[model samples]
Target: MRQMSVRRKRRDRPAEDAAGPQVPDLATKGGRLAILDDTEMARIHEVSVTLLAEFGMSDAPPIVAELVCAAGGRMTEEQRLTFPPDLVARALAGLRRDVALCGRLPEHDMALGDGAVHVGSGGAAPMILNIDSDTYRETTLGDLYDAARLVDALPHVQFFARSVVARDMDTDSLLDINTCYAALAGTTKHVFVSAAFPEHVADIAKMCHIVAGGREAFAARPFLSLNINHVAPPMRFSPDAAEVLVAAARAGLPCMVNTFGQMGASSPVTVAGCLAQSNAETLAGMIVAWLANPDVHAVYGARPMVTDLRSGGMAGGSGEQALLTAAATQLARFLGLPNSTIAGATDSKIPDAQAGYEKALSITMAAHAGANLITQTAGMQAGLMGASMEAYVIDNDMLGAIRRSLAPVEISLDTLCATMIAKTIRSDGHFLGHPQTFDRMKSDFLYPGLADRRSIADWQASGARDIRVQAKELATEILAGHFPQTLAPAVDATLRETFDIRLPVARMTKP
Candidate 1:
């Protein structure tokens, strides 16, 4: 494995240092919710092991099958590759625990496997909720770039992934290249993108290389990683996706092998059964990546969702979905691997009270469950088919609240405030004017940006705007001004000259 270069940019350091009161990167230290006990975890692991040893994986591509066979897996009569228990154990134990996903700038880097919580946007939504027209429309490449810039300005949104598809792009390869370009051009934060074909991986890599100054620099500290869903439910690998996974692993880019099994459809109805199946599938993905390259930085992503049995449709925002995803996160922790999961995906078509409550419940549950990386926390609505600009801003406030909730309560003598309390009672008769209160106001509490917190009279006097209206206004303001200058003029020109850079430079700078 190539060690990621952690050299800091000289010019960017001062600005990062001066960006006062850093959002403390936190983990759930105390109230770590675990739905699965040791015994249950053991059961899930054993079941997963059994499934791998017997049921095995089907539909592996020729390269994946060869890799599996080379790694001591056996081919069954049904043409499925069966992995022994020891193989799974070895892959699990050999995984690199302290994985640092390096960013273009030092401040954007994320260290995984410490149970630290990080929230970000997620992928592949086909439709966009247009605030201007008050209707849903097909997503475009420009919309993807705008969404990335909006997320970049949000303090609570830690990383920027490709949240919506570029429906305007005609070809898959074009889609692949342009999506990668949009994400990197929109945010300097660590990026996550995908390729349609294994061949397109090199094109995306070349673009990243140009942006990072050279191939060596990009390989040394890959600013972008691939989010490849390697498998369908019940341990079925897509041949094309497998090829992409193999290519990404060999390229030294970190891969999140996300397995999203819909309950009662792709997976078993019971939570434990769904978890066990997803675990087996997740381990299968890890095994393939490990076999391709033992040092591959693989994240055990479990995104098992629920189905509204009555309609037989996805119920991503349901309470059951929250509980199931939280449990899956626990299973990932039990295996001691860096993990990611879906949270805050509302089934509502619009950003409303239902969206608020559903997003809060799921996001809070996943954060409390010790998920290292939480995706789908912004923009996603209508059970992951649609992305909303207004919802992303509102979700930022919710994410801040979640982070505050996960933060440990400092009870040291300095924070104890015994002296300050006594002094305030004795002299001022109130703590509002005290130094400690003033000092801790911004540092301790998180104020919402879009949520209404005014009296009814004040609210009515201002504009009588609701949360969605406020969020839309804020989103518009942010979109109008927040053009990230992550790419230099020379680099941008080189990329446009070298590849089919679809996004015009003028559009990126202005609107």
Candidate 2:
């Protein structure tokens, strides 16, 4: 009678308080979310091709114009360079799909063109959330290096792109050189840096060769890549970045031709219109890179940004942004090209609850859509205007959970455990003492380094700190102790002498 009363009490609880039925256990699958069907994708492609052939892109460098004309492209009466459908097809066919983003260490190498997903850090924010003060300040060279070290220590962050601009640099050349050097010094994983001038590309490549042992060795692996914002909004090329693209491609460095168009501002207001324009611009950039060096490794980076129509401000954390990026990933898959896109950039000023939900929603969508490289997944804040060290630690935990959700579940005979279940029923009711349970515990489960899973009483006993406090403590520890020896002492001295490397050696070592 007492048991029956307890059951009735549980059943009569408020719907919100009562636990719902358990979710069905199922195998994980990806690339299933479809915002556009085949016919819609076909229409978008048709529109993109039409935009390229008719409207074309303006402000092409003379060399680019010459190369495109030589390859069946033409200059419009309005001086815009236009690509015929056949020419675009040829360029797409000539794209090198088997590109490898090699890290300094072999275990960190990642092959592109597969549908597998990778998340990493990326941005050029001039400011950083100071770890000590919890206030924003101009990012210095040390800040960039510290961010790189944090990324190196975090397993979920796959690559280290230049996350913050060194505001202390005196010149663009120094900024470019030091940015790449700092990233290389802080992590052995893949590094991506931007060149401010076309001539700077060779100097940066020279530094890479010094670290890589020789020119030939660097060329063989090429752990560093160049990020060139070749296109400026709706069907136009930035002449300087275009020149940098040419230089980087000719220097035998992998180039990610990034085109960011802000919808309702730099691009069309509608999502499809934004995608069409961005796709055309990305194709034009790739064609130019292909012309510069037929064997150049190029990644198709089509990033269509979102804008809040009400205030005309960048809305990177919006649900619309997630949809646009996922659709862009699908388009890249459709073209059979190695591609990348931006996601997980929250507009929040701090890494709060808002940041958490915004990042998870966008990143999950992009990962499921099979974006080969999803940048801006960690440490970014304030609409990509700030980098947060604590956020990297926190986001690492989030990324791990998301990755676990994407892992496949085993359903074979052994995994089914019918015999073990029968034996357990015949003996004890639970499998706590079973050998298989012991064997599978570590293999099948992922324990977060930061997330607290303790019971309520235990959590309170342990001081009940929030995630932010825990993350700050972890970030502080990593920044203080985890300086990677990416270059030998001799190599480091050689680079310091070769370029105006401004990061102090003392900062890179533990005292």
What is the C-alpha lDDT profile of model 1 across 275-345, one tens digit per residue?
99999999999889888888888888889999999999999889999999899999888899989999988
**In candidate 2, where is summed lDDT lowest over 10 consecutive residues?**
1-10
Local distance difference test values of all predictions, in order:
0.84, 0.86
Best by lDDT: 2
Clashes per model (N, Cα, C within 3 A): 0, 0
Which residue segments of model 1 deviate by more than 4 Å? 1-31, 418-429
What does candidate 2's lDDT look like per residue over 149-211, in tens digits?
888888778898999999999999999999999999999889999999899999999999999
Give TM per candidate: 0.93, 0.92
Cand. 1 Cα-lDDT = 0.84
